[model samples]
Target: MSKVEIYDTTLRDGTQAENFNLQLEDKLKIAQKLDEIGVDYIEGGWPGSNPKDIHFFSRIKNYHFKKAQIVAFGSTHHPQKIPQTDPNLKTLIEAKTEVVTIFGKSWDLHVKDALRISLERNLEIISDSLAYLRSHVKKLFYDAEHFFDGFKDNPEYALATIKKAIEAGADCIIFCDTNGGTLPFELETIISQVKSKFPNISWGIHAHNDAGTAVANSLMAVHLGATQVQGTINGVGERCGNADLCSIIPALKLKMGIDCVTDEQLAKLTSVSRYITELLNIAHPPYLPYVGRSAFAHKGGVHVSAVKRNPQTYEHIPPQKVGNIRRILISELSGKSTILSKAKEWGIDLESEDPEVQKILQELKDLENQGFQFDVAEESFKLRIYKARGELKKHYFRLLTYRVHDYNTLDGRPIAEAEVWVEVKGRERHAISLGMGPVNALDRALRNALEEFYPRLKEMSLIDYRVRVLPETSGTEAKVRVLIESRDKECVWRTVGVSHDILEASLQALLDSIVYKLFLDERREKC
Candidate 1:
């Protein structure tokens, strides 16, 4: 199999996503996770741009990545500015990265318009910066910014820009589908021409999703002999977004027989992708290939039956390879396989052909036909399954009363005070605490209350938390929804809590987090 390099720009590009940003420490944590997951290159950030990014490279030195090279991303050295004085160029030197990637204009329109520079100066910007950066970093990647449009508009100029970078000793010349509007056929043809024009130059592909064709264009680029792939994990970036590395690396590995990422750590890819999203406080892309929760989930009866008969009948790849598993969801359209699968996932030991399976499926269908959606709330789904088979444990933490105080303030800065009383293991206990936020206060009080009875609860903290407000109406009367995530040293679990009162919604989720931990503990004790 051919080897294609996978460069993940999640920290640089993915952070620009809407409501998605990571602090310097968060970036380092995610960078380490990416390294553990075995990516080739990690684009840390444009150190020339943000203070957090500038601090990231320095602080990240406290740790080292084994399987990935940390790459610093920035624009080409400013036109006519001396390389030493240019902050952009200096940032590259300061970042201390082994690889430095800089982009220059390939399109004349950008030269005359955005840069307001002459055409010849643009070529100088490309080659001169690459040559200078080559003297500094071990590897230099030159992104032909807007290369596809440049090729389509002026093929000669685009080819000239790349040839100039090739002459300057760039390790790779990456074609940028910046607008992401190029069809696969057009992208393949343009790339093939570039390959032929610069036969000796190692080529790369970086595509966007403006037209929702980023993944397809990147795949086509690989098919046409591009040796490197540049993208963000989960397809996050400015505007529409960039190509997704999560999809690209697997497509290169499983689909195209290319070894783009580290070999043995493919299973960690799913958790790595998910961990980045969780740290960024963004939801994982639902349909992301190989890593999404719904990637191989089956809801249709025909699909479930076929999957049971022969997994290849419906699955594209085995789900186990990436720390993920196929989910047969129970819905109105679910079959007995769906029920059987859910039973198994919930640890119930019912025969696949048991008549009770059909009855449970019908029951789930009837419930779903009303307003129940078990797929999103698996805790409740487990409860239903356990109850149907007479396997439910009694409630662990029975809520006695919970209260919220709005008047906890020191010198006028107000914070929430939470008081929670619960019946735990047949004993009544009370806990009270204050926090910067209502949910935090509730979580702290609950954990404090249960520490004596459930000491393991002290080790468990809310590592990744989320809140989703689903608006069904306008203004004040809207029904609000909340989702909270809590994790400890080992694993993570999410609980959904919804109410008109935001405090109540958060409290409900906080309650579920404690109960789920206790429930799992009781199960372990039984085992």
Candidate 2:
């Protein structure tokens, strides 16, 4: 098998995505993870772009990397300026990295329209940029921006642009599908042409996902002789996204029998994907290939049964190969077989014929009928089962009652005050609090009353609250379902509640959230 160099541009290109910005500390943390996962090159942001990027480059120099070379990214010299005098090129040298990657205009249209430079000047810019950086850095990679589009428009000029980089000592000439509109067949044909033209030149592919063929195009280029592949983690980038290294790396190794990351490093794919998503606070796509939560999840009764017997029956590859696991989701659509499968995974001693299993299944179905979705609220489902089987401990605090009052203040702003009465460990406690809304007031009052008894409750807080109406037919009177995501230092959990009134629905979810946190603590103590 041939080796493909993995160049990660998550910190550079990934930040261009909407709502995907990372702080300086976050970028440093990600760079460490990338190096630990054995990426060949980690492209930190351009040092000349902002003070943060400059600081990142300065700080990154202090750390020792294990396997990856930190590469600084920037554009080629300005059309009117010489290489030594170009600010962008000067910052590239000042970043003090062993490798530098710079992009140049490949499309003649971009030269004339975007840069407003003659075709001859663009070639000189590309050559001078690489030649200058070639002396300062151990290795240089030239990115031919929009190479695919350029080749389609003027193949002669595009080839000439890359030849100039090759002559100027670029270790790798990376042909980029900047617009990401090139089809796989077109990419394959173009890559084949380039390989034939320069048999001895080191080649790479940098693709985006606008056409949804970034992975296919990248692999096709490798098949045609590209030795390096550049992408962002989980495909985060401008527009559609860059090729997802999470999906592409595994495919290159397991599917195509090409080696990019080692077997040991490949095992960290799922964790790396999740770590990045978690840091960004983004909802990971459940259906994302390989590393998604639902990638190896079995939902259908027949599929679950077959998967239980042999995972290879329904799965293309073992979930563990990518550090992911098979999941058996329980829902109203599930059957007894699925329940038994999930129970077995949770270490519960149960069978399909158990009366307890039947009881739990019926309760789940009824709850689903009442607009409670267990698929997204598995923590609530587990708590329900534990309560039904008498394995759950008694409540730490029993709610006697709660009252909320809404009134206008002197300034005419609506204020909500809540009074909560709860019995904790045989004694009753009363607390009152005010909030901007009824839900917030109730949450504050409840926490105020309970915090004294269970001081650990101070650590638990609601991170997100979501509500959805059951049906549009009832309009404002429709039953609403509320899901609350709560997190403590150790873990995060989701709980659900439903009611006709919005406040009541939120209360139910809020109560469940607090109860689940205590329940988790109790289980930990028993263990």
Candidate 3:
């Protein structure tokens, strides 16, 4: 099997994305995770550009990585200065990383316009920069920035720039699709031509997603004998982002028969992807390939039925191979197979011929018609099954009454206070709390009233709350659906509610969130 090197640039190029910023601590944590997944290189950041990156390099020295070599990214020496005196080159060495990667102008257009240097001078800097860093670092990589576009405009000059870096003792020459407009076929042709010229030199690929084909171009380069693939986790980078290593790694190992990551390292892929997004406070895109939430999720009745018989009927690869599970979505479109499959997953033994399956199916459709979407809130769907099967015998707590008062103080700050009365184990408990909104007040009040009886509820807190107004009705009278995402130490669950009043809808979802947590704890206790 062919071997491919995975170089992660999430800490560097990925931070260039709009609204995507990371602290020094966050970079170190992500680098540790990348190391755990067995990536070949981790580009920490451009130390010459930012103090946070400088701190990341210094602090990261406290711990050691097992497999990944920390890399410092910079540019070729300034046209006005020699490599030995250039501050950028100085910072790269001072970063004390095992590997150093510097990008140089390969496009004559960039040389004349961006760098304002002659083509010959740009080639000279590329050679001088690599030769200076080659002795300072264990491995040195030359990123021919805009190599594809340069090759298209002037193939001879582009190949000449690469030849300079190779002759200067650079370990690898990475062809960068800096503008990300190169198509896969164009990339394949250009790389093929370059390989013919430099047959014995190691080659790498750094592609962007402007043309929506970064992953394709990276894979094509690897197929054409490029050994190194550079990308970011979840493809987070500037513009449309760089090639997604999340997609590339699985394709190389599971699809392309390349030995990049072991099965154990592959299983950590999904968790690692989500962990970075979570730390960045970004919602994990459910549509991402391989490691996304919906990657292996089956929803259509026909798809679900076929997947139950054989997952290969609808899925290309086993989701478990990438550390993702096959999800059977519940909705009006779900067949009895979907319900039985979900029930089986929840450890409930149910047959296709079970009368309760039809009952649950009808209830699901009826609720969906009432603007209740169980697909995103599977915990609510699970409760529906439990109720249909009479497994949920009694209520954990019953709401007696609730009232919310809203007013503005003299300082012109609006505040809401809620008083909640509930019966737990036949004892009435009442609590009052203030919050930023009426719904928040109600959530706080209710939790305050119940936390004494079930302290485990304190472990669970609402992470995300979304309200959607049903389009069937318009204006202030429209029905609303509330989806609440809650999490404890073990796992996260989403529950949904719908009502004519937004506050009532929020209350219903909140109740389901607490009830689900209580039910899970009770079930675990029984086991």
Best-fitting candidate, scored by TM-score = 3
Tens digits of per-residue lDDT for model 2, 97-135: 999999999999999999998999899999988988888
Model 1 C-alpha lDDT per residue in residues 438-470, reported as the tens digit of each score: 778888888788888789887677755555555
Where model 2 places Cα greater than 4 Å from the true spot, the runs are 392-397, 407-415, 424-427, 472-474, 525-527
Candidate 1's TM-score reads 0.80
**Distance from true location, Cα of 466 in model 1, Å:** 9.2
Better of 1 and 2 by lDDT: 2
Steric clashes per prediction: 0, 0, 0
lDDT of 3 by residue, 1-527 (tens): 35789999999999999889998889989999998788999999999998998898899889888888889999999899998899999999999988899999889999999888888998899999898888899999989999999999999999999999999999989999999999999998888899889889998999999999999999999889889999999999998999999999999998899989889999999999999999989899999999999999999899999998888999999998888989999888998888888888888999888899999999999999999999899999898899888988898999999999998989999999999999999899999999999988998998899999999888888899999999999999899999999999888899999999988999999999899999999887321
Ranking by TM-score: 3, 2, 1
- Worst lDDT 10-window in candidate 1: 368-377
RMSD of 1: 4.5
Alpha-carbon lDDT, every model: 0.80, 0.89, 0.92
Q: Considering every candidate listed, which one attains the maximal lDDT?
A: 3
**Local error of candidate 3 at residue 211 (angstroms):** 1.8
Task: Name every residue pair that clashes in candidate 3.
Answer: none
